[model samples]
Target: MEIELSLPEPDPAEQDREVIETLINDSKYTSFAAKYLREHKSEIDQLIKMKTKFGNTWKDVVKTGLRVPNSKVGFYATDADCYDVFGDPLKYVVHSHNMRDADPNAIPQRVVGGDQLSLQVSDACKERIISARCRFARNLTNYVFPTSISPKDRVAAEAELKAALDKLTGDLAGTYTKMGDLSQEEQDKMVENHQLFHNKDEFLVKGDFYDDWPNGRGQFHNNDGTVMVWVGEEDHIRCMSLEKGSDISSCYNKATKMLEHLDKHVGLAHHKDFGWLTSCPTNVGTGMRASVHISLPRIKANMPISELKDICKKNNLDIRGTGGENTGFAGVVFDVSNRRRFDVALSRCHY
Candidate 1:
């Protein structure tokens, strides 16, 4: 089924034409939202009036860019924002996904590769690889995106996930710790170790993701901490697996196993047009990001950051700081991950 969107009559007085025009013209404003608004000035009126079934409007979609002119993604509250409010912007979408083109008739399906005994990297490349991680954003088929989910429903969703997690046995047995129950020290350690998520992200904050603070937000990790999941983040759930060195197979296998268990109990949302529905369009397809932390001192020393970025683009890889997206690399250690998240075979997407 298609997403629902409303095109209400444009309100002239609500159009902050000159104000938006000025921001779009600012050199610091280079996010996707800014670019879209600048190029489609005429659609501002319609965009302002457009609303998703959950009541997200253009203001919700572009607030990130307006609030932080230098924001990378800008942001979108729901899946419908991609086609309904943003006009699809085929060029931008395809480019963002690092795909060749968008074929209207094509229905891309997700194909995951989770071999437990295989490694994805070459022996030589493995030397520089510090760790491997696999994670995917997921939402429930019956629930609205986090940005629009009511507090009561959000709590219900978390309870449902907790029940499913409680059923996990063997290596997957663990605890679900709510953000509200975490102490300052506990939160700090998790953040330092990259085991927890914070609600302070400007983009998500502007998108209205942390409505009731940490009421329904929490995280679950296996006894060993290798396999984990974040509940009520940007998406309804984010399943992850981490392994030392370049063990893609183990990472993928563990994450996929947890995801399958969750799916068996709580059903994940999926669509023909968008393999896995998510809060943001960028993660629509597989919604998976498989990455490796590696030391690249030689490359860092010899090539400029811009040149290295171009090379990464050519190779369908994205390099970021060890801290994650929008952060700068820490010395020579960098997080290298797949750039194409949509329209690609999931099996191949991870490699």
Candidate 2:
């Protein structure tokens, strides 16, 4: 006798079945993302096939469209203000019409970017390495995800950010160049600078983000390349500051100064409860990351990669190869960084 089996009912509201199925049918989902969703189908409230302005959304695409993975990834599809639109969890509901509302009493800003990131990585440290970096993602209030960000929106936003950069004098003074406007030679040089990583984002594979080829993407950096802001790289803006050693305060100051200036003049995405808002949930809170690169010759020589990675994982640390993730490690140097971005304070990241 044949037996009938019952499958759990799917959540109608979790995801738009039509779009999810369509992307799957079209082979737009990454093997990793598709496989991941399929394996953990239960934890997912919904499988959203979202649209970004430039690239496709990946959670560790939030890496986050909720850049997913990295210990805790901010799933963009579910957490996006438009997708789920969760308002202040306390004053509002999980998926409200608006999530940008900020509380009056909440701190206007988190850390003073430049204050805490001033220390330099010492030469005498056990690992002989110390560097600090703070990166942030910002979204505009008017646009949907990057998928739907209109050309007009991209141009206007770029102009606004560039204008702010122009206003700054001294180290912050610089020019904003659009990807579409650069000459082939300049573009090649930019790529060879070793500053910008090749966009190997999985979302690009899934979403065809390069369809127009540099429609609105651009970069803003100081002459020394110390202060750089990637225009339309991941989110609308990837504000970053790099420094040698562990002077996190200096790094934060450089990046935050730009963000604050823009926030005051143009505005940024933020919520009272969630702090900063982005396509990735992991990036939502303070929208800040502090990282250090340590050359652990002793540790690398003594420990296996698997074992060493495991130890870092247990302690809320993230590691990347010396040459970054895709490329193999460069000798013994490794990119070690904090694991959490939400709720956790900036100071704890250093600890």
Candidate 3:
């Protein structure tokens, strides 16, 4: 005797409803993605099938947080997804950034050319600061972000930035080195000097950022290495300036010059409600993270790390390890930076 097997057809309607209900009621999961899904139950089918130009569906936006289990705020595929898919959810989420009562639809515009020198660390505090660094993130206009940028578009974008960087004059003159071209030793040296980015980040890994790895990525730094730009890192552009001591003004000014030059030569992505268009909504406004590596031996000796963290939180500041985020501090030295990326004016930022 012969036997035949039959299988029932899959149902998208049933699948969509299950996805919505599961995420909405998941007590262990708390993120903006789940919040949005619960509030928009009627649009479950539309969201399930919706895809941005960069091929980011609602699934892509929430997968990292849902899978990681401990992720905060989750992640975004592109700037468009924030407004088109997760706007209201983000309004509640960003409130944690001290943006209480702020309209997520009315983020301030990008502010540059401010008097960076206006704010100076007092002489006593300056004595403990090892170095100062000011860095900001930027993405190119008319291009998808790094999270889902096509390999072809990646090369084209790099070419555009390289052309503009090649035109730097005076102290800004520097060389752009392709990541794939660097030897292992050379790569190690760059990492040691903190001039290169690595692919060890779990958040970036889960987001598919390292796909087609190093195919169209590079770094550009000025002759003195004070000014630098990481091309095709987490963001399309990671522009920064660093110098010894607490002369944050120098770092800020150098970075501004580079930013203004890029803005004029190659357009930058800017959102009307969000200052800058970036892959992540957390960096939507300003896309700036100005930081300094400071030594706080006395404070460290007296206070526990948890207490220090609480104090930093109270003052609208963030404290990181010497190696940067997700790492521990080196000896008594720490990386102290502003916590507010949006709503706060750049001109008002003082160390």
Candidate 1 lDDT tens digits, 71-168:
76676545433444454542364356454665434434433334343655788888999999998898887676787788998999999999999999
Candidate 2 backbone clash number: 52
Clashes (backbone N, CA, C under 3 Å), per candidate, total 0, 52, 0
Give one digit per residue, the lDDT tens place, for model 3 in 192-227: 879998877887888777877887789999999999
The lDDT for every candidate, in the order shown, is 0.76, 0.58, 0.76
Judged by TM-score, which candidate is best? 3
Candidate 3 ranges beyond 4 A from true positions: 1-22, 39-46, 53-55, 79-86, 96-99, 103-106, 114-116
For every candidate structure, what is the RMSD over all alpha carbons to the true structure, in angstroms? 7.0, 9.4, 3.3
lDDT of 3 at 66: 69
The full ranking of all candidates by TM-score, starting with the best, is 3, 1, 2
What's the TM-score of every candidate structure? 0.81, 0.71, 0.88
RMSD of candidate 3 to true structure, Å:
3.3
Model 3, global lDDT: 0.76
Q: Per-residue CA lDDT of candidate 2, range 78-150, in tens?
A: 2245433322121221112222443344422543344444455455763465666778777765554454456
User: Which of 1 and 3 is ahead in TM-score?
Assistant: 3
How much is the lDDT of residue 248 in candidate 1?
75
